[model samples]
Target: MCETNHNHNIKLDKNGNCNTDEHKTWNRRSFLQALGLVGGGSMMLANTPLSVSRPSPLSIALSQSTNENILVLVRLQGGNDGFNTIIPVYDYDVYANARPLIRIPPSEFINLSDDYAMPKPMNKLESVWGEGQMKVVHGVGYENSSLSHFKGSDIYANTNLQEDDRTGFMGRYFGEIYPDYFFNPPPSPPSLQIGSIGNLIFKGPESDYSFAVSDPRRLLQIIENETFYNLDGVDENCTYGEKLRFLREATNTTFDYAEVISAAYERSPEYTDSSYQDDSLGRQFRIISRLIRGGLGTKVYLVTLGGFDTHNNQIQRHQQLLTSFSEAVSTFYKDLAADQSEDWAGRVLTMTMSEFGRRFRENGSLGTDHGTAAPTMFFGPALNGSGFVGEHPDLNNLTRGGNVTNTVDFRQVYATVMKDWLCVDEGLVGRSLLDTDGGPFESLDLGFNCSGTTSNIPSDGESLSHIPTYSDSQTFINIVTPQTTHIDVSLYNIVGQKVATLANEMLMEGVNMVINVKDSANTRLSTGPYVYQIKTNNGDYSKSIIIS
Candidate 1:
């Protein structure tokens, strides 16, 4: 098991310095940075280049069914301090008592409701709220939330509490919708991910669905130059050489979308919104607005704003982060509203998500520690009205560790958005979220519905279940099939080189088939981690397995 350290649980002295031995551990960001993946341009996952001549049936169907509504997921990279962001004016005494130094004065905050107010740094949202373009879902989080940044992020992205689960909910949805995604990707990039390096949000079973760039500047360079790596000289004879060649080819194919992105950017009007600061978050929103206005057709876009882990000197740091977020978001809508022909502002929905919230009580430092539950803010005219969705977590009822119990499950929020905003089918949304374990999660009404238009994608209703297990000597794959289906199974190395074809035959109905890797491969396999992909008429599923 990986070592877990809670940032808020660290012992600090009166000087606001750690007094205990800090466990120097690797989080997802640092690990990706060490691998030279973070801030090193775009990440190319295992996806085939989209064919220009012929669009797939699934692609055409998605194009026709989708009403051009887009979802922008803004990630507050570190855990945001919910108490500070959404001040509980009704319980101001308890809130002030917890953080007297960092608490926002009543005069400094703008009142949103009789009970709740927002800090002055986020004053820009006040106008948005008055226009009925904003809504707050109070105390949104899961039970037993992981306070560790890496794990918490994974839980949010994958919607799975299991530590070993790697696939994300969006990835699973894309996998189901485009079962033949490896051979035929959609016309445009399915999603565009900017920043938030090493996040699994768009990770499908066999590949990642997003065209992920390190930053807005790198994306602009790709758009301007139509850049791609040349794979002419790569030797493909040896195993390592073959993997390198494959990766390079994949990287080049990823740049294929650059042409469309560039075309869209070139056709769109320049951002003249002076309210948008020339900061990281502002730049991201600016680019996203251009793509949407220019008809890129991408459905989802994820952008990041870091430095939310306000462990010390909370007042100034939190203020700056929230200020950037508020200004960029507010200005983005105005930029979209400028395009009166499209009503682009109504078609776009922006939502904020952080891994978790800060503790109810303040630590020795002027900041709060990692806690549970925070207010999730939804912005855009599509919401129809501005209001709170759920009750705020009670300050009097805190966990033994000084964390508030989440009043609303974050998955419920995801399910609702997927069903309503994106027009995804309710059943498919449940499956995509892996909500089968506890039965389907109930959706919350956030003032909008799908308008009777649903996705054309078909759901794989318990047709197959692919499970992989390992013994001391060999690996075994247990597959359950409800009906006879042609199944193809293959294994690939970590770098995405095809290692072996395990099976290429039909699976009988109502039969539990367990295939031994050693016998199926008919060769000695390397003793390390490998991914096994199961392809069937139902869908494609993949999981990581260790060979001994």
Candidate 2:
């Protein structure tokens, strides 16, 4: 017979095996009280059944309606040789010469229209890229970097030069941006990281905001502990009375919240099928997509696809590696696109980065070794087109022996996303996020030069009549700065089609200079992503923003 325990929250007949509680004891009062409260590894109170259909207090407090804003970071484990991944097909002669046997024939690539394209396996991305929703940042890395896989990944993950603290740069961003969310569980699910194991990026002081969930179906098994909650034997050892009470309260509090999260996930759709690798990492991404689709309230999700440590048989292995990596990512993006969740299209941003790129030349063993400077790809929603951000160094001009000299630092990318993409303020983000051979990079300027000085300088009084503003329901984007007197701002669609003319005239050197835009009427344009470019008479500035 199945044993039942009421107050203890645990049940065992005689053999001392755990019996499922089904969260019967998770109560409403305890559940609501724990809502919106940050989490910690401490004892909690006994639980009672919560209101079935009511939203958790935490979810209500966040008021975070589905904005569709999601960040998915896919790590291509093992060293992905950049040279072959995005081979210079136009310059195939040089590439073929470098990679004699391994070079993928030009015909094999998914021809990305203008002479460049991803490998055949990455054809999935080619479709998205052609659609203008995916972006590829080429030749991104650091200078004088350690080639060790662990050290390199540390650099990518932490974005710190010395790699001292080991906290994820994203973790710090999440911690600072939503301290309460990081400290407390979101009303739906874990905020920062959702996987079988929590990453360093999700770790915070007193922060149990991360949950290492392997199976959403199994989460309830951990949440409802029948033996611990029952009033009868909770004090079986009968130690300190005060300690026992503290433990009970803490346990109850945590389990009550956990129960709510488990219930939400239980209703989420499962995406994985036999075609997926059936690996732990594969399963994790599938779950992540489900949670995101289910509106789990996760902001940044991280999952690593390992086995990139290609030392031997690097040819066959690396080929398969890239194939699997691209396939998984391509499918993931498609899944997000198919998701009917309100936030899926507008808010979700999926990106990938490695510790560093592989060496420029193949090693003696026909395999490329650890090197620096690789490309990072940002896929999904408002992300702009594909192109190399930093210049790829000449093959002959190596950094040390033959390492590709890094033109753009990795942290610059992080800072750009943090400051511009995510609206995080680097100045107040605390501590230098990336270690420069010099110091922290200038706050990640998204290449949008808004300096206060420019030549055609419109005086303060000049009515920049074209300046856009939210006069009514129309969305107007105005470019103003302290550096330039006049700047040009234009809107472009994914097809490289210039949609609306937001600003093509002069502007003053002050704040709130609104520019009236033509063709910006809500009805004229369909809901989707658009790129905004600002070309100052002095320099060029561009940023991508989504219009709801």
On lDDT, the candidate that comes out on top is 1
TM-score of each: 0.71, 0.63
Per-candidate Cα lDDT values, in order, are: 0.74, 0.54
Lowest summed-lDDT stretch of 10 residues in model 1? 45-54
Model 2 over residues 431-536: C-alpha lDDT tens digits? 3364434444554322322233222212223323233345554456665566446666667553334666665556656665554443543224433334455666
What TM-score does prediction 2 earn? Answer: 0.63
Mind sharing the TM-score for model 1?
0.71
lDDT of 1 by residue, 1-548 (tens): 11212321222345644322222221322333444432324532211111111122333443334567899999998899989998999999999988888889999989999999999999899999999999999999999999999889889999986555788898887766654344333446657776544357777775554433444456456656877766665443323333344445544544565666666866888655566788888877887888788888877888899999988999999999999999999999999998877889998999999999999888898888899899999999999999889989999998999999999999999999988889887777888888857657777878888886755544446657777787766789999888899999987654455779999999999888898987888766644456677778865566566665
Question: Pick by TM-score: which candidate is best?
Answer: 1
Supply candidate 2's per-residue lDDT for 28. 25
Q: Which parts of model 2 have CA positions greater than 4 angstroms off?
A: 1-68, 113-115, 177-186, 189-196, 205-219, 222-242, 269-281, 341-343, 429-548
